[model samples]
Target: MDRFTERDQLIRKWIYAAAATIKESFDDELDIERKSNRNDLVTNMDKAIEKQFIEKIQHFFPGERILGEEGLGDEISLLDGVVWIIDPIDGTLNFVKQQDDFAIMIAIYEDGKGQLGYIYDVMQDKLYSARTGKGAYCNKRLLPTIEDRPLKEGLVAISSALMSKEEGLARTVGRASSGVRLIGSAGIETAHVASGRLIGYLAATLAPWDIAAGKIIAEEVGLIYTKLNGDKVDLLQKTPVLVASPTAHKEIIELLKSQKI
Candidate 1:
């Protein structure tokens, strides 16, 4: 197998292992702690999950640096070599409360280019993945390109956090669309856009681990991912992001120009 195929198989194995771990320990009492605020919580499982991936990656692909949400991996400054961006649990609040909307995610990059991406929905047991130049898939079934629809003709999602602070902005966008949804998880929301279920997903700010995996999968399926202002996102810092179908992206960009997204 070529390197992409080899690493693709390896990441699938690692993610399956993670799924099993989450299923096994989900009901147990969690050692939860707050980060940044009470709403930003982290559990023991989060740390364990990230630690597990880093260990497996080191054992199988030593010297490959990792940047995990929970800080279990290396302190990466540049994307010089093979780099892995991992989000152990994409929706910690949803995972802690509903246990339904969370996801496990990993994105592999080579010299700053996205090579492989994986997003595993823990409750549904669905895996979405992509290999650069190849197609995207969910449960091994190929996904179609995002429908090129205008904002008014398409369903879409805006971050709840973003909406609350900018209620008028949310209302404006919603009024211009068929409807609005809040998936509470970037990975899952991006998957929806990739599968043509929604035309767009917007977030005011998201970290590298939050957007990396989904960006690869969505972009491969012909969706556009960039900042609200029509700039490419740098997968190394937190920034506002818009993952949308081509038609919707252009429309949303014009609408969001005056706002501080």
Candidate 2:
């Protein structure tokens, strides 16, 4: 089998294993702590899940390096060789608050290029994945390329942070769209866009793990990804992003002045 095909098979198993762990912890008392502030939290489950993935990836792909949210993986400055970027639980707040709308995600890169990405919506039991030129998928079903939609024709998701801090920004975009949603999880939000359910998504700030898998899958289905300032998103940095259908991207990009972000 080709390299990614072989790795993809095993990666699915790893994601499922992570999901199993997550489901098993729902009834248990969570160990939560704040990162940057009270709003940015991490739990014991997140650390355990990241460690779990590091162990499995090391076992299967011994030489590959991993970059995980919980600092269990290697400390690499660059994506030189095979690297796995993982977010054990994308929406920790949602997981803690509602146990829904969260996801498990992994993105595999080889020599700095995205080879495969996976986003498993734990409660929904839907897996969105993609390989270069192979198209995106939701579980066993293939997703058709997203229709090139404009901002007014469909629902869009803007980060709660952005909606609260930049009401003017929200008003400019919201008045032009059908509606706005507040899905806290970037992976699930991106997957929805990949699935053509949401026309676009924006976030005030996102780490590498947040967008790693979603970027690959969303782009596989023709969603355009870039910074809020119209710059290409750097996969290794934590920055704001605007991911949408081609037309919507153009519309939103133009509506907001360069200094808006």
Q: How would you encode candidate 1's per-residue C-alpha lDDT over 52-158 as one tens digit per residue?
A: 99999999899889999999898988998899999999999888888789999999999999989999988888899998888899997999876799999988899
Per-model TM-score versus the true fold: 0.97, 0.97
Q: List clashing residue pairs in candidate 2.
A: none
- Residue 143 deviation, candidate 2, in Å? 0.6
**Which residue runs of candidate 2 sit more than 4 Å off their true CA positions?**
none
Encode model 2's per-residue lDDT on 102-171: one tens digit a residue: 9999999888888899999999999999998899999999999999978999999999988887888988
Task: Locate the minimum summed-lDDT window of 10 residues in model 2.
Answer: 252-261
Each candidate's clash count: 0, 0
> Which TM-score value belongs to model 1?
0.97
lDDT of each structure? 0.90, 0.91
